[model samples]
Target: MTDRVLYLVVCGAPLAKRVGDGVRAARESGWSPYLIPTDAALPWLETQDLEGAPVLTANRKPGAPKRAPVADAVAVVPTTFNTLNAWANGNAGTYPLTTLCAALGARTPTVAVPFAKHDLAGHPAWLASLAVLRYAGVRVVNPHDGSSTALAPVASGTGEEVAKRFQWSWVLNQLQEAGA
Candidate 1:
């Protein structure tokens, strides 16, 4: 896995605050992880903590890391329902969306760990997006299917209570399973 780059795309979901943990987890799984947070997710990130690991966001200053490495694999953890629908519809409105689209276009293996609320999970758009991504060869991990830690409903409060619900390990496992 040396030299392999795993792009971790973080959407603006509640669990996005723990993206640094996900990056570390990805490294443990033998990948050099790059964190690309959607514009909506930027407020959750603490720049100092992500040293060495490249962080790509919507508003890059003159001296910031301007380019993301070419990805061999992509993991979209904290894939909120909105992002899922947007990405599925090929809406590259954000860098995170464009990066995911580029990876899919190149046939690079991609794994998505969605954090949709229990309510929205049943919506037609959500289901159809999942199906579309799957049909396009994206590996989608549903937390509610008894496969990993269950995400709390959207109303779940912040801090320790909700933190316990995100299945961070599942993203690492999926990326590894995709042969990243």
Candidate 2:
């Protein structure tokens, strides 16, 4: 399983700041993780220690060699509103979005942890988008308690606190259960 690849896709939410913890955990679990961050996530990543994993923030130049192995599974941590909607809509306009879209199309074992405030999650599009991903076989776990059945939206102004309490095991356990 040392060669198993896990694409740890990250977004701009405050939870993005704790990505290093995910990377380290992935390694400890025998997965070779590659960090794929959205442009918005770069700032948070700037301060993280990624356990020396490769960070693929942009698509490679045309004809350039592939930088990472094909993913055995994918985990999207701190899936932001824009990213979740775009991914559910099949809009691969950005690298991270493209990664997500491709992962879904490939039917890869996937777990998504959304970290959005209640106000933003109230948008009708949010529930619809989540349904879309779930129907497509993506395990959409609640960031609060890792529950797959119910997603409790984060309260406004509580993102930092939520990020702190997030457990990477929630995401990892889902992937493991999927036989990743």
Candidate 3:
């Protein structure tokens, strides 16, 4: 198998499909992508057709061999309002949150893409969380300003054309620099 990158999906129902599309694109580009869903998201993911991608459970321990740092970059696609708020406040209570904390601790470059209803996305709490995440060294990408959805291709260009268009390229460069 090709070396894989860890892709974490928080809890956006709409964003999951977009994320899956991005995963398909990334895999087509020759990267093995793995999905880890939050506890609140498992049931939904099970009901959807994810094209056979593996799902990591919330309760799984941190030391499993499969959990090793295999990717130079970790992307948190469609981060929900709750999860984003929790992460900004340093709450590592769930699998996705804990994994994110670990990745940050290890100094892995991360790209967090937040998705919420337009009103919620503009709320003060969400904005504050975005600021906090930036302060914590996480690259925060949003679907605004004509960027594509952070992970998936744009369906109608409603949101940003894509958040952090440079992300995958940056990650690949980082991996090359590390001689991975």
Candidate 4:
């Protein structure tokens, strides 16, 4: 079986924090972690002192050899509406977009956790982009209240709740399905 790595991509500030929290949770859950930030997030990533973790800049070309390290299951946590739309339409003009397109084309499983406000969440464009993503075989998990769930804390009673509900079992299940 192929080894699985968890690729967490961050876009915005709020989502960046959630991604950090998710990374912490994933590490605590005993999974390997690989973090990459889009150009928009590079400054923030550098400020956090992520240590020696591989950091890919957003300015790099999308299909470069360096991006081959991306794993099977990628979680675009707190995906901005713009990024979601771009990926759905095959617009790999940015770093995150290029990485996501490459992974999807490689038949890698992708999970998107959108983080938009209620008003923006219900926008027609957002809904349309979601449909495109689903049609493209991307797993789109939204917040239960029809809002962006990834922006909220995991409903679990533990104070250590992540923005999204990523159970260890669920992750393992997907990995198994991917033959990892």
Candidate 5:
């Protein structure tokens, strides 16, 4: 895993606030994690600071980034419901989505840590999207239930319980298991 480049892409979700710790945890686990935040997730970095990781996003142009490392595997942490659905339906409309879609095309191993409200969780479309992503080889990690949907909030509160319950460990562990 040390030689592999692990990409940690963030979507807008409550758990995203504490992802810097997850970044450090990933480093401790021997993975080189690059942080990629979705356009909606961009504001997260303004209030949160993540050290020692190179952050990347698409330039909206049709070429590979000059400085971006090719992803050996990807973990879309705290993936929002909309992002999850769009990604499943082949919507590479955002920078994060475009990058992830490319990685999927190249057969790079990918994982997703989803976070959604209870109401959203019950939607048929959301469930189907989870299935689509899983069928496409993305290991959808369901922190709430062992079942598919693959979403779980750390705690009922905001992002405070992340250290105790966010399942950052699970994400990194799966990345390792993916040979990331």
Candidate 6:
């Protein structure tokens, strides 16, 4: 296994369909990536190869051994409106949320690529949540590029088109620069 461990957390969004590409890219970059998909993301993952990376959907049973190695970094690709708001509000209602909250609490080097549409991004809570996460040391990158600048919301009915051109390198570069 690689010395670098990455928790590749995925949410249900059009971008999720390309998650296998992310996993392969992580491996190619020498990171041992583990998949942590929200329940909504399951359908998209059905066809992903995962490159043998372990998929952790739920917490281990009490007293059970750990599911994967400690994460050296985290990449929350396709961070949906629901997941973003919930995580920023510190809601650990789901396993993915619990993982995100714990990572924040531990100050793990984290990156989030929001994939919400313009309509959802118009909500006050959307920007507020991104601000909260940024204040807490998470690197919020634009889904279109790796820029740390303010993200532009995806246009309606164009999520799949956006996903098609999304590059895994954007997220990987952020983690590398973070020294993860």
Top candidate, metric TM-score? 2
Ranking by lDDT: 2, 6, 5, 1, 3, 4
Model 1 scores a TM of: 0.81
Q: What are the lDDT scores of the predictions, listed in order? A: 0.75, 0.93, 0.61, 0.61, 0.76, 0.91
* Total backbone collisions, model 1: 0
Candidate that beats the other on TM-score, 2 or 5, i.e. the better one: 2
TM-score of each: 0.81, 0.98, 0.70, 0.69, 0.84, 0.97
List of clashing residue pairs for candidate 3:
143-160, 146-161, 147-160, 147-161, 147-162, 148-160, 148-161, 148-162
Residue 31, model 2: lDDT of 94
Residue 51, model 3, lDDT: 69
**1 versus 3: better TM-score goes to:** 1
- How far residue 173's Cα lies from its native spot in candidate 2, in Å, is 0.5
Candidate 1 per-residue lDDT over residues 40-150, each given as its tens digit: 778877653664788877646688765756888998867888889999999988788988888888889898877766678778898798878888888877543415334
Task: Report the candidate with higher TM-score, 5 versus 6.
Answer: 6
Clashing pairs in 1: none
TM-score of 4: 0.69
- Higher-TM-score candidate of 1 and 4: 1
Question: Mind giving the per-residue lDDT tens digits that candidate 2 earns over 14-129?
Answer: 88989999999988899999999999999999877887999998989999999999999999998999999999999999999999999999999999999888888999999999
Model 2, runs deviating above 4 Å: none
Candidate 1 achieves a global lDDT of: 0.75
Estimate candidate 3's alpha-carbon lDDT, on a 0 to 1 scale.
0.61
Worst 10 residues of 2 by lDDT: 45-54
Candidate 5 residue lDDT tens string, 1-180: 466688889987766777788778877887788888987777876666587687886664567446666878898987888988888888988778887788778879898877776677778888899888878888877655433443554444534444335667777767667776
In candidate 4, stretches whose alpha carbon ends up further than 4 angstroms from where it belongs are: 28-30, 43-51, 59-70, 143-180
Show the colliding residue pairs in model 2. none
Q: For model 2, what is the C-alpha lDDT against the true structure?
A: 0.93
Ranking by TM-score: 2, 6, 5, 1, 3, 4
